[model samples]
Target: MLKNSLNWIKKYKIHFIVWALFMLYETVVIGLLFNLYGNPIIYIAHYIVIVSIFYVHANFILAWALRDKTNVIWRLPFIIIIQIILYILLNYSADLILIGLNLIEVKGKHNLDSTFILRNLYRGIYFLGFSTGYYFLSNFLSQRKKTEELEKEKLEKVIQQQKTEQELIIAQNAFLKAQINPHFLFNTLDFIYHKVNMHSEIAGEAVIRLSQMMRYAIDSDEMENTIYLADEIEQVENLIYLYQIRKTNDLNVYFSYTEDVKHLQLIPLVLLTLVENIFKHGDISDDDDIAYINLSILNELLQIQTVNLINHHKVKNTTNSGLNNIHKRLCYAYGNEVSFQYQSIDQHFKANIEIPVKLLKLPI
Candidate 1:
C-alpha cells in the first residue's frame, strides 16, 4: 500500500499541486467570509471538511478518467458526467446542512445561496481542462522515457559487438603465430636431412639441438600467453646453436643477467623473432662480418640488442609481417611499457628492444 501511494504521488505530483492550490483558495474564501460575519473557528472547520470532500472527488474522477477501461470515448464522457452529478449532489447536501445549523446564512444582509446546478457546470469545466492538460503531459513524459531506454539499449549492444570483434581479432592473431613455429621446424628438419645425406659430421649436433628446440617449442606452445624468461632463453640458445652449425662463418650469441630472473617471464619466442630476422637478413658467411646478439637485464629493463653485418650487395627483401606480429604481441602484453626500434647503418643492421623488467619478474 505504501509503495503504491509513493508511486501515485510520483506519477501525479503536478495534479496534487493543482488540487492543493484549489484547497488553499477554498480556505481563503472561508476565512474571509467568516471574518466578515461568522465565527472563524466554525468557518475554518466547515471549509476543511468541504475541501477534503473535493479532494476525494477529484482523485476518484481522475483515477477513473485515466484508467484504460473500455473505449476512451465512452469511458471519459461517462466518468465526467457521473463525477459532475456526484459532486453537485454532495456539495448541495453539505450546503443544506450548513444552512440548517445556521453556520451559513442565505437570508437578508448575509446570504450564501445554494446554486448547485451552476456550481456543477463550473466544476465540470474545471475538471475537463485539468484532465485534458494531464493526458497530453503524461503522454509526452512517457514517450520521452521510452526513447531514453531505447538509446541506452542501443549503446549497450554496440559495446558488446565491439568487444566480440576485438576478441575474435586476438584469437586470429594467436592462431597465426601458432602456425609459425611448426613451419620453421619443418624447414629446419628438411635442412638437417640434407646435411645428414651429405655426410656432414655437424649434422649429428644439429639434430640434437633441433630436437631440444622442437621439445621447447612444443612444450611452450601449450601456454596461451607467457613462459619463463629462463625457458625462452634456453630455446633461443638451442636455435642459435642450430644456426651456427648451418652457417659457414662465425655467428656469436651472448646472454647475460644483471638481475635474478628465476621469477622472470615473457611471452614465448618474443626475442626469438628478432634473432630469426637477423639470420634471415644478415650476412653470417664472413668471419669479419659476424652477427652478434646480446640480451641482458639492467635498471629494471630487459634489453635485447642485435647487430648484424648487412650485405647491401645481396638482394634485400624483408617482410614486415613478423615485426607487425611482434608489435601486436608487445602492445597486448606491455601496452606502453615496452619500446622497440630498428636501424640500418653503414654495413650493419641493428635492432634494440627494451621491455620493463617488472613484466619479466611477474610470476607466470
Candidate 2:
C-alpha cells in the first residue's frame, strides 16, 4: 500500500500540486468562518474529520474508480453514486460527533435531511471531475515514458552492433598477421633446404620473391577486405614454384588466363590459402594421384576448382586455421556473394570456390 501511494504521488504530481492549492484555500476559508463564529476548537475538529474523509476518498475509492474501462456515461454515473454514499455516511458521522461534543446545536431532528443530501451530492460531482482529469493525465504521461524508453533501447542496440563489427575486423587483422609469419617461415625453410641439397642458384630468386610477398602483406594490412586479383595470382604462382623446387615427387600445376585482370579485385591471400591447403594435405605422386588446379575469371566472377587424389595412408596433421580464417574473411567481405564447397569421393578430394567479381571491384 505504501509503495502504491508513492507511485501515485509520482504519477499524479501535477494533480497533487493543484489539490494542495485548493486545500490551502479551504483552510483559509475555515479559519475565517470559525473566527466569525468565535469557535476555534470546534472548527479545528471539524476540519480534521473532513480531511480524514477526503484522504480515504482520494487514495482508495476514487483512485481506482476513475481507472475503470467502462463507457464514460456509465462510469460517471457509477462513480457519482459511490461517492454520494460514502460522503453521506461521512457527513452523518461528523454531525453525530459534533453533537456529542456540544460543538454545534442540531436544528434538525435527524441527519438524513434534504439539505444534507443536496450538499453531499454537489461535493460528489466535484470529486468526480478531479478524478477523471487526473486519470487521463496519468495515462498520457505513462505512454510517453514507455515510448521514450523503447527508442532509447533501439538506439543502444544499433550502437552495440557497430561496435561488434569493429571488433571482428580487428580480430581478423590479427589472425591475418599471425598467418603471414608461419607461411613465410615454412616457405623460406623449404627454399633453403632445397638449395643446399640440389646446389641450385634458384634459391637466390626465391629469396627475392619472398621479400616481395612480405612487402605486399605489410602494405595490404591497412585495408579492410579486398585486394587486387593480380596480386593474389602472383603470390599463388610464387608459392607453387617454391613447392615444385622442394618436392622430390612429381607435382604439376597449370595456370591459364583468358583476359587481362586489371579490373578485378579479391580478398587478399584468399586463393593462396586454398592452394596452400591443397599442397598441405593433397597426395602428389605418380599416375592417377597427381594434383590439378584450374582458376578462371569471366562474366564478373572468379571460379576456382582443384582436384587431388587423397592418400588414405597419409595421416592428416594440420589444423583447420587456414580454412576457417578464409571463411571468416569471405563472410566479412562479401557476405553471401561467395560460395565454397568441398567433398571427398572415392579417394579423390575436390574443392570449388566462386566469388562475385562485382564485390571484388574497386569503387569508382
Candidate 3:
C-alpha cells in the first residue's frame, strides 16, 4: 500500500507542484499585497474546497459532458451553471459552520448582494476556465504520447522485417554454394545401382533404398511444414529396410498402420525418429522378442506407439534430445491437443505419441 501511494504521488508530482505554488502565491503574495490576511484555518479550509472543485470539474464534469461531441455546447454550459450554484451554496455553508464553531469572527452580517454574488460568480468562473484549459492540455499530451508509441512500434517492425529478409538472402546464397544438383546426384546413384546389380542384387537394392531415403530427406527441407502421412510412413519403411539389410535380415521389428491414415497429414521426421531410436538403443536382434511400432486413427486422434526391449549390452550414451525435440515440435504444432510420452517398463522401453487429426490439411 505504501509503495502504491508513492507511485501515485510520483506520477502526479507535476500536478502537486503546480497546486502548491499556486496556493503559496494566493496565501502569501496576494495577502501581502492586499493586506487581507486572515485566519489560517479559513485559508486552509477554503483552499481544500477550491482544489477539490478544480479536479472534480476537470476530471469528472468535463469528462462526462464532452464524452460525446454531439450536443456538447449546451450540455457543458448547463452543467457548469449547476456547478457554480453548488459552489456558491457551499461557500455560504462553510462560512456558517466556521462561525458556529468559533473558528472565525464575523464583523458584519452576510448578505447575498449584487457585489457579493458577482464576486463569487467571477471566482467560480476563473477557476472553471483554468480547469477547462488544463483538461484540454492533458488530453493533447496523452494523444501525442500514444502517437509516438505507435510510430515506434511500426518502425521496429519494419527494421525487423528488413533484418529477416537480409538473413534469408544470405542463407539462400550459402545453400546454393553448398548444394549439389539433385538430378545429378540421383543419376549418379542410379548408375552405381545398375553397375552393382550385375554382381549382387541385394547390394544394389540397398543402394537404391539409401538413395530414396536421401532424396526424401533432401526434398523435405523444400516442402511445406507438413506432408502426407503416407510419405513419412514410406520413408520409415525404407529406413527399416536399410537397417535390416545392414544386419542381413537379422533385426526383428514390425511396422503396422491403417490404410485410412494415408490421406492424413503430419509433420515429417517424427515417426522416423522413433524408429531410429529403437535401432539405436533397443535389442532388436532377438527374434523371440520383436520390437513393435503401431500407427492408427482412433477417436479423432492419430496415435503412434513403439515398444522395444532395452539393449543393456549397448553403451547408454544418449542425451534424449531427439525425443525432447519431437515433444517440443509436436506441442508447438498442436498446442495441448498433442501428447508424446516415453518410459521404461520392466526390461522394455515404450514411447507413444497422439495428435488430434480432425483439422489436418488434406492433399488434393
Error of 1 at 50 (Å): 99
Badly placed stretches (over 4 Å) of model 1 are 1-201, 252-263, 313-315
- Candidate 1 clashes between residue pairs 3 or more apart in a chain or in different chains: 265-360
lDDT of 3: 0.83
Model 2: runs farther than 4 Å from truth?
Answer: 1-200, 260-262, 313-319
Clashes of 1: 1
Winning model by lDDT = 3
Clashes of each: 1, 0, 0
The list of candidate 3 runs beyond 4 A from truth reads 180-229, 232-364
TM-score, predicted candidate 3 vs. hidden true structure: 0.52
Q: What is the TM-score of each candidate against the true structure?
A: 0.42, 0.42, 0.52
lDDT of 3 by residue, 190-308 (tens): 76667666656766776677778778888988888888989989989999998898687999999999998888888878898999999998999898999999999999888899999
